[model samples]
Target: MATSVNRSCLTYLLHLAQDNLDFRLPEIKALLALRGKSFHPSGDFQEKTPFWCLDGLAEEDVRGVMARSVCAKSAFELWGHGQTHSELRTSLLNYPSENMSPFMHKDSTYRINVYTFNKTLEFPDRIKRIDAMDYLPFEGTVSLKSPQHIFCLLEDYGTDPNDIPEHPNYIYFGRWIADGQRELIRSHSVKNRHFIGNTSMDAGLSFIMANHAKVNENDLVFDPFVGTGSLLVACSHFRAYVCGTDIDYNTIHGRGRSSRKNQKWRGPDENIRANLRQYGTEEMYIDVMISDASKPVWREAPLFDAIITDPPYGIRESTRRTGSHKDVTKHADGIYLESHVPVSQAYHLSDIFTDLLNFSAHHLVVGGRLVYWLPVYRPEYSEETVPLHPCLRILSNCEQTLSSHTSRRLITMEKIRKPEELDGLAQFADGRFSPYQGHNAFREKYFSGLNKRCIKEDNKAVVNGQ
Candidate 1:
């Protein structure tokens, strides 16, 4: 009863990686939501900082989040924290004895680690910092090799690197729980993957998107513009059943020219399924087909648990769908030879998002999520520019800057209710709701200083080659 009482009052501290400052909070919150918990910060929360103190979470909850997060480095059961060492000592001494006794018993073995953020410490200085903690009642044996329990003393010298302070701005001491999945970023890097494409999503961002979608084991996830199956690979890592559709027949069949260097053509067995096999998740692979996103192929029912994709922005890859504007007289008897091929025309950016939201509203289960990327021209971008639908509610919008004037926002939305006739008509009810209307216009804005005609011709040649 005493242990439970002490644990309930305890606050946990998270040591996060400094990169991707905008994404860490949502990732942690979504992971906590999976375990039926809410984010409760203990103090003034600063999103850009490396340390976050959270309240109302058990050790198991912390461990669960650490197991999956790539943005966080480690989590700790915070014992004490303060702006100065003297204050920290007072806080530590004031902590309940019952909470510390369990891990500090004389029969146990433990290790202490000193971590400094935005600063470096010499070996002797690190040892001095550890020695300064002699006031704590640590009766356990010190084992540096393999300890049964680990504790950490973390110091934050502030985020600015140029101005070095004589003392740390903040300090925290806690019992370490678990480290996050940062290793996955390195292990699944696109440079090392067996199959890849020019616009393959980065490994870290792929996992981050999966988390934002709340992907889980046994869930059905779909990607509309699944180039090289990078997003599928991330979902499969989380044990979700993955499938996708792409308009590019060459990509779907894994044929034609290769995206890899020093390779002329793709080899047999060099496809999405093989990529999953390389990651030991081949069983999660459902299928990848050659189909246009502008057209509907699925039945009229809620099927997917999540819809996650990265649509082409006409910057690195051309956006084309199955259709032609030129009037074509029907063949005699409406029959064509087997050698005939379907013609493709430019797919507008606005129409792509309109069809996407409508498709998601009809195809995603209630409470399901839809995650995708929206390219934006920085000067004109605003919340109103995001595409909207009646059945879907906006959850998060995180930006990844590509250039001085261009960025892509990762937009996540949830299906609140089933679609209705009235709902479809009311999608643009908001006067401010405006979607991207043309790929050429966006491309022109993206490449304002360059020769527009030459760029368009170059893009046409590249598409023709593919």
Candidate 2:
């Protein structure tokens, strides 16, 4: 037993939330990268499992990850684990005596918690499970209310809900380290937000986007299509100075219709600034303006540390940009008259992504991140359809299904190089660039799916009448 025990070596176990399964690993990797640590899994590592054992990290590193992770529930310092209860007993008994002695001292007070995944145990059954661990030496006084130390016995019954086994597939014993920032999701929910739009991002996803951007303190984050400033709010929470621009005058100035069911008009203080103030991060609010994304207002050279945004998908809002008629003649000095109103033209989805990538390539500092959403028509979607650029490297692509036939992918990329004059004017013809021209008809595809569904329902109604 002593041969198998090593007091100095330790592993940490992460209990990750089951939802947003695809985003969890990238979020964890990004957070770990913030501390200059790489993820090193112990034994068998499964991405879909709720439980994961991680090696090559200190307790402080685990705490750092928990501080920012919304996808993880809690972390633990692993003592032992095994496939069977008998195997677990052997593993626990072999755990270094020195490592166990410090927490089990007679003067200390501790509690043992029973945590079961995918199954619930009755009171009697839970007590029986706890009582079965009598072989180990725990000299500490049992404290139910306020324990100086907390230990957990976790049982994994596998993921299938309908086919639960009589016993757990695996068992683990560990010391509870820290709980993650899952509460942020509830506290920052869009339903309770001071200001929101019809397509305001959910709180959980907003934070996830910020994480993917690797937002840091004192960083400058920009959102070119900042509708209602949801992304700005998330960046501000991380102590980053947040600013954005929107083509919609109403959205930028917060003068449009209220998104709430009963409210007809927006309140006096219902704006992005008020949102930051609501969360006590108003000091990080840089400012927002009304501008066209195609024509950036920033001066030459890298200006932002990160650019995170969600461009208009034409599903909830119209995609329009400032334009001038070909017949409209310019003045002798090549300027528009003061009385001329800007013409609005349809902003195709293809050009939207092309201009966005070009803007980020030129405006973002090298190594800075660009995180955005790309709408998809499920039947026509493929890896080849995603837009790309020479200077930006794709980091992660995660899909969030909207309906049976429609979905959107969250794309994260990092600016790797500055664009030269020739590269800037390359017209996206390089092998590396896969222009999203095919997606220009996304609006039509989206509505066609809806129309098909409606027709199918109508046919069903007619058949039932017969």
- Encode model 1's per-residue lDDT on 25-118: one tens digit a residue: 8889889998899999988888889999999988899998988899999999999999999999999999999999989999999999999998
lDDT of 2 by residue, 1-466 (tens): 4533443257999999999998999899989988889989999999999999998887889999999999999999899899999999999998877878888989999998999999999989889988998887989899999999999999999999999999899999999999999999999999889989998889999999999999999999999999999999999999999999998888887887899998999988889999999999999998999899888678889999999999998989988999855666667998887665577899989889999999999999999999999999998899888888888999999999988999999999999999887776565557547576868888998999999999999999999994
Q: Where does candidate 2 clash, by residue pair?
A: none
Q: Cα RMSD (Å) between model 1 and the true structure? A: 5.2
Residue pairs in clash, model 1: none
Taken over the whole model, the C-alpha lDDT of each candidate is 0.91, 0.90
For candidate 2, the TM-score is 0.95
